[model samples]
Target chain A: MQPKSVAVVGAAETTRLGKIPDVSVIGLHADAALNAMKDAGLKPSDIDGVATAGISPVELAHYLGITPTYADGTSVGGCSFMLHVRHAAAAINAGLCKTVLITHGESGRSRVGAGGFGRAPSSLMGQFEMPYGVTSPPTMFTIPVLRYMKTHGVTEEDLATVAVIQREWAARNPRASFKDPITVDDVLNSPMIAWPFRMLMCCLVTDGGGALILTSAERAKDFPQKPVYILGTGESVETPMVSQMEDFNSSKAFRVSGKKAFDEAGIQHADVDHLMIYDAFAHLPLYGLEDLGFVKPGEAKDFIRERNTAIGGKLPMNTNGGGLSYMHSGMYGMYALQESVRQMRGTAAAQVEGAKISVSHGVGGMFAASGTVIFTNEK
Target chain B: MARLLPEPTPETRHFWEGCRDGELRLQRCTDCTHSYFPPRAFCPKCGSRDVEIYAASGKATLYSYVINHRPRPDMGTEPHSIAVVELAEGPRMMTNIVGCPQTPEALILDMPVQVRFDKQTDDISLPLFEPAKG
Candidate 1:
């Protein structure tokens, strides 16, 4: 269903980003939820719908004293928040709920009240992938990158350029965890976590949370802040294990979700003034740009190396420093959405000047799932 | 410290049993003629239940890989290559590359390889890969 009338009326990150050892996983959710409620000039009693990932919606609603008419807990992975936005829009358009709040919280760095995730030995991954020593995301995610590099003729230097460009974007934002400029040499020289992935190429681990409130476009104007209209949204999932991805060179989910969003938005690629591709690792943005049709396959590395996605570039992407240099609290989709809203509202820390349209895309579980959202301030 | 071990279930018992007996077994679909790894009840390609387990040719080609430097409690401090190999019968499986240096220079993509079992426990034997010998 086309949710033409749904819009983001409220958006806010937790008061403090980066490191917060004091806040539990649920506490981070409440902090961001409370901040977003204040941003929308709404109270807990005003919310009738709740959606969240990482943490359950039931816990969020009960903690915030909200009894919702509808609730959605679509936890695919980091991109779960993007899926939540899509689901919330559909729910609102269907008259399932009037006001909806979507939240995300992760204690990735602190590990306080954080949930433990692992595959059972009896599970498919445990029996197949894990037995050979594929344990964490850093290792599992690299399974495809080597193939991608070999097929595309992408060198280690080209991969380093991905980190360098994002770090350039990160240097402009104060809230970014690592603002210091890093060179391609620095990225290559950084300690190796997995082959083809160095320390600088990976995302930062921090503790933070973000939330958004959505309502019908008719009532969005009544809110204090400008409403970022949800022009289009799409989400899709592939396999549970990263090893089972249909193609090693590309993410099928990213292609499906992004194409659907672009088709629904009815906008050309040039119309996107801002873009956010979840940068959990350097290779992701490369895959995202190609899979989303912004650049041709085996060409994103050159697109980035030429400064096409950098600060002065035609397409300002990951302007919030991205998860690479910014605060990645495990589930980074919410932060990407927050930056898109901020760019549309003309209030971002590293604002892309005169930005009207923004496309926020996210990946969950090492390209296992994807969600794409197209937002615009033209109401 | 020893790394995590696989605990075979009723469905995967045959696969483990084959490995312990020095054979690489996989499932083949009667309807679609599709061969696959990781024991399952139905054929993943055609969704056919007419699947049977048989000893594979034990030949594969290196598809992709990474040399992990980070030391796990069980994996020791030295770097090792975690690789995916496409079997001759037409399915890829994750395994460690043995009988070769775990470096990008040595682990060539699409190179011919064969499976070798390393018995992790009395009942479990993990399948690994090595350069194919003439």
Candidate 2:
């Protein structure tokens, strides 16, 4: 409830990202957790609280030999880590635990010790959607985008511009997976995975993980890394089926989640010097821009086309190139959170110049869940 | 390879049976008079247990869709359209667009459509949609 009561003291991704075939899912978790622990100069014994998605918090604690007083396993999908960060901040503020470690990892491409993405025969999605030939994220996550485009009169070129601009940002970061400059024509002319969606519009399916360490703001200075204060946080969930989203043009979950964080932080859109709207697909950031109040409805496409979110733009977004050109190991929220911290710490690969505030927002499932976390370097 | 079929629960069994009988059934809340799908015992809105199963008009408008080019083992070689159609009663459900080519040019948004049942098994019949006949 109290802003700036908590801060991220340490944050790190696995030692190497993008195609870590040898690392199992749990191994990636441990890799990121240990990396973050080392970054904070803390040991496994120092963590009194633990939280994660995919693997249970209990499993993470037992695997890392931590005896935690608080643990959370709130699995909502890719954005689950954002919720973990929010919950950990609350737990630390309540004095439930001294230090908290939040972790994420997915064997999305490698499938090493990875579980299948099957649902029960009687599950809601299984019953209604699966029979309709909805096979993967490309098919399901993209269900509503066409309607949004049709209503707004957005063109395929506008959609291609999203990937083009993100690739421009990707060219600046050394950690990016695809650093080559791509044109809108390149994106439009690429292989079509689904109608209105090309290969470039979808996120990369790589193998990677990231972690964050949270503690009381009072103790934040003791850590080795710059203290990235948790300025505000909010999260919400909507319908399970993509078809059931209240509106196709805008995400109710994104609106509710983003507005809560902004209201809680007591900041305006202009206050955010850096932003990372989860780009599991290109359309997400478009929806995010409008729903988060950064742009008016139907203006997001133009905002992006005019290059406001591109490199050297007024608002430098997804500086790590986002999930579009960056490494997306299934759950992309952790990576989004990591970039925010990097910007706030002033050590990002493509750091925004003197950025003081950063907002990281994410979606889970197909517009079904959302989480927003605001960070500031100002204490 | 077989397409995934529904294993109906008591709460949702009527929906499947309605499709098998060539009817698009939905649950409507009596208290609020709100209609909905993917059957639940209590009304989603107002949480009223006072609900009834009723046959819908089967008329809908094409709300949105994607033609998945990524082939699934269960789905055939031809690209298929996965769509969500808003029914005449206001509820939306996921279904396939049939009786037309699965292309962006052919399957226009907001086009009027009517429901058609594709019987999968004796118990599980799918409610697909096609362009409204003139």
Candidate 3:
């Protein structure tokens, strides 16, 4: 269904973005949720719908003392929040609920109240993948990247440039974890985590959370904040195992979800004033750019090398520093959504001037799943 | 300490058992003739319950790989190659490329390889791949 009149009324990250050892996982969720409610000037009783991932919606409801008429616990990993926003809009339009609150919180650094994730020894990954020492994301995610480099003729300097340019954006954001500029040599010289991926290329492990409040555009004006109208949203999933992706060079899920969103929004790549592609790793933006049709396949390396995605470029991307240099609390999608809202609201720390349209895209697992959301301040 | 090993379930007992007996076993759909790995009860391709087990040719090609350098407590400090090999029977499985150095120069993409089993536990023998010698 097309999102006709749904708008984000409230959006805020946790009071403290990085390294909050004092708050547990649920506390981070509650903090972000409460802040969003206050931002929208709403109480727990004012919310009738709730959607979340990582932490269950049931637990969030109990923690916030909310009794929602509708609840969604769609946990597809990092991109789950973008999917939540899409689902929330559909639910509001269906008259299932009036106001929906979506939240995300992960104590990735502290692992406080964080759930353990691993396949059983008898599961598909255990039998087919894990026995080969493919245990963590750093290892599993590298499964496709090497082949992508080979097929695209992407050089190591091109990959390192992703980290370098993002660091340039990060240097402007005061809240960014790594504000110091890093050179391409710095990234390539950083200790290698997995082959072709150095520590600099990976996302930062921090404790943080974010929340959003959505309602029909008719009621959106009642809130204090400017409404960021939802133009389109799409979500899709591929194989759970990274190795089983349809092709190593591209993501089928990314293509499907992005096309659906762009089609629903009736917008072209040129219309996007600001963009946020969940940069959990440096290579993710390259995949997002190509798969979302913003750039041609095998050309993202050149796009970044030319600084098209950097500050003062044609397209401003990941203005909040992204997961690579910002804050990656396990699931980085919520943070991506928060940045898109900030850009649309024109209140971002590293605000893109007069940004009218913004797109937030995310990936879950390796290339296992994807969600794309398009927002416009005009409406 | 060593890396994690797979524990066979009732549905996958045959595949592991075959490895113990020096054979690479795979499941094939009786209806669609589609062969698959990691032994599932139903055929993933045709969604048919009519499936049978058969020994594979033990030949494959290196599809992709990464030389991991992180030192896990269970995996020790030495670097190892985590690879995916596309089997001659038309399925890819994640395994390690052994009998060669774990370096980018040594592990060429699309190089032909053959499976070799290493006994992890008494009841389990993990399948690993080695560079195919002509």
Top of the candidates by DockQ: 2
Candidate 2: stretches off by over 4 Å: none
For model 1, the DockQ equals 0.75
The true-versus-predicted C-alpha distance at residue A143 of model 2, in Å, is 0.5
Q: How high is the CA lDDT of each candidate model?
A: 0.90, 0.92, 0.90
Question: Distance from true position, residue A346, model 2, in Å?
Answer: 0.5
Per-residue lDDT tens digits for candidate 3, residues A1-379, read 5654899999989999888888999999999999999999999999999999987899999889999999999999899998999999999999999999999999999888887868897787877788888767889877888889889998778888988998888998898989999999999999988888899988999999999999999999888999999999999999888777768889999999999999999999999999999988888899899999999999999998898999998989999889999999989999999999999999998899989999999999888899999999999
Which lDDT value does model 1 have at A253?
Answer: 97
True contacts kept of 3: 0.76
DockQ of each: 0.75, 0.89, 0.73
Per-candidate TM-scores read 0.98, 0.99, 0.97
User: CA lDDT of A74 in candidate 2?
Assistant: 96
lDDT of 1 by residue, A1-379 (tens): 4635889989999999988999999999999999999999999999999999987889999999999999999999999989999988888898999999999888889999997768897888878887666667889877899899989999989888888888888888888999999888999999999897898888899999999999999989899998999999889999887767778999999999999999999988999999999999889989999999999999999999889899899988899889899889888999999999999999998889999899999999978899999999987
Please tell me how candidate 1 rates in CAPRI terms: medium
User: How many clashes in each candidate?
Assistant: 0, 0, 0
Task: Write down the worst ten-residue block by lDDT for model 2 chain A.
Answer: A128-137
